[model samples]
Target chain A: MEEGCSCIYSRMASRFSIGLLMILAIVLLMVRVLYVIYRCGKPLPKGVSQSFTTLIVLGSGGHTAEMLSLLSVLRKDRFTPRFYIAAATDNMSLQKARSFEDSVAEKPAVKEASQFMQIYRSREVGQSYVTSVWTTIVAIVHALWLMIRIRPQVILCNGPGTCIPLCVIAFVFKVLGIRWSSIFYVESVARVKKLSLSGLLLYKLRIADQFFVQWPQLHKKYPRAHYVGCLMIEF
Target chain B: MEDRENAKRVVFVTVGTTSFDALVKAVVSEDVKDELQKRGFTHLLIQMGRGIFFPTKCDGADGSLVVDYFTFSSSIADYIRSASLVISHAGSGSIFETLKLGKPLIVVVNEDLMDNHQCELAEALEERKHLYYTRPHTLYQTLKKMELESLVRYTPGDGTPVARIIDRFLGFPDD
Candidate 1:
């Protein structure tokens, strides 16, 4: 009876220890996230002005085309933004994006050092939680490598799919005192209506520093959002 | 006799995506086929997209509506040019492409059973009067009475709105 009592006590102690460890880990993670948010929410550090070298554009399909067209128009002047196109595997936009980058490289002003990262398509498996987590991990590693190599001050995101992972990496960098801003391009008013409740909640997290929307109606939706008249590359 | 025959109205059916069930229904329905035959519409050309299954015979109009499934080899611009009236799915890509060609388009919304987004897109287009929208149930009736030239013109420009939105976010000049 004493041996059984001791065994029960030991089992309870082990369980307590595991629970305690999990609680400690969660607390540490929360602290890190809070720290990141605090750091990124602030202004850039003084006397550390660097020219925007690389601009990572994240999206697939027609959204990428829209970004490339905007970049082409903007490339005419002083700002020469290098392209980092992130896409999903077997995406039609990714194939076209390669050709777009090749064509842009031919231009005198735009120096091409394009990197393509493929994320797993969510549609195939009805939202892949495991693949999503894996993609996020890979994105963080890739972002760190690119930050060290390319040294971009600005990250332009066209949509949520690719941007969400990239933005998390940006937040990590922000915590480390690396100066960067995330610019989000809003496609349509219809998109705002289509966002899932979880997505809206995530948006409130302010992963993006600035949001530009085509429709004036979105200005009401995102009070802090800027309404740009429109960006177009005239053919 | 040849001159008179050449002047017959050409009805063009363009399927932007194979997922469009309304287009399939419109083409295969016996009632619609009979009505089209009675109307003396000449040279019915059907542009089939990927994943769309075509019947061997469209009720004795086998040769009338030629199905070009996933044929990106030839430019579809030529077909849009020759079409007197263009019938298509209500995808933004198709709507813009057809409008750019200055053709009269009758857009059929792929039902909620097909895709919910199609209905939303069709509703938006109908509100703008850019194209005539046909629900799955009323597609045949809508097509029969569709007046191409009467459509309100909605010009779809380049991605200026999207660009402007991005520029604003980037803190660039709105202009």
Candidate 2:
């Protein structure tokens, strides 16, 4: 009878210890998340120089145009070895990107600095919701693979649905201490009053390191977003 | 054919990548054509994207107005650059491209599109006197009332400020 009572007590003690460990782990994770969020938008402790590989996500039409405009003004010499990712379904965006690269890349170094990659869109416009679930999984897997391969130091994206997966993977990498790819999201000039779905997700979740909006109204709406004025025009 | 030496006053109308049938229809109507001729626009070029409606009264129409249109162009920059006036759908891409070129622009907002954020951009630019915005039904009136001389030239926004912020975030010292 004593042996049976001791066994019950030991089992209960082990279970209680396990539960306590889980709670402790949860608290640690919460603290870590809070710390990471606090560090967002601040300069990195160890800043990288030269050989900075940047990953640029290009959406179709307007998004691509806006992103290209932003890149036109960015110091290309500083951000070298760019990897441009576009949706497989979007044929024009990467072509435009390549042309833009060619236009800006006068030297051999800048000329050889760009590579284009295509990923499947999570959900194409007008696609049924039922089939999109499978595609979204496929897209997430592809995004993970690309993220691991590129391991970019900096990521730049505007309002594009394809960017959501890549940004999320980068955030996970940040949380895991694998890579700290600073994500910079510029809300499209078209979105004045409301954030796009991708922008809202990254903003609410604090995935993007720095969020920029073209209009002052968006800056007012999303206090965290930097009001950088319209990005479409090149000075 | 009338005067080779005189610069042809071209008015470019772009619907961008999406099909804006209402915009295409409104721009090509007889009233709009008459207004174009009255305004001394020698040529009218329409970029009708995937729209089923094609203006039947194009090319060599009895009057001095020469109307031509294509479904798509590899690059519309050249067209926008050469145009004296630009009539465009309220797509932000189209709006900025025209404004950047310093062309007198009239933005036609397609009300049919759901979740249309195009109006916000169009209205904002219109408020700034960078361009004019109107619905398809009122495009003719907007065109008639447009004061190209009064329209302010758009001063291109400098990306230096944004780049500086990015540099700071990347821990690069400002030069």
Worst ten-residue run, lDDT, model 2 chain A?
A: A43-52
User: Which lDDT tens digits does candidate 1 get at residues A1-235?
Assistant: 9999999999999999999999999898788778766644344443333234446554533355456656665443323455565654545566666666677676644544555556543333355777767765665566566556655566765563655545665666665557565435344323422432223433578666655554454557766566653342333
Winner by TM-score: 2
Give candidate 2 misplaced runs (Cα > 4 Å).
A46-48, B4-7
* 10 residues in a row with least lDDT, candidate 2 chain B: B56-65
Per-model CA lDDT versus the true structure: 0.57, 0.88
True contacts kept of 1: 0.12
- In DockQ terms, which candidate is top? 2
TM-score of chain B of 2: 0.94
User: Could you tell me every candidate's TM-score relative to the true structure?
Assistant: 0.69, 0.95
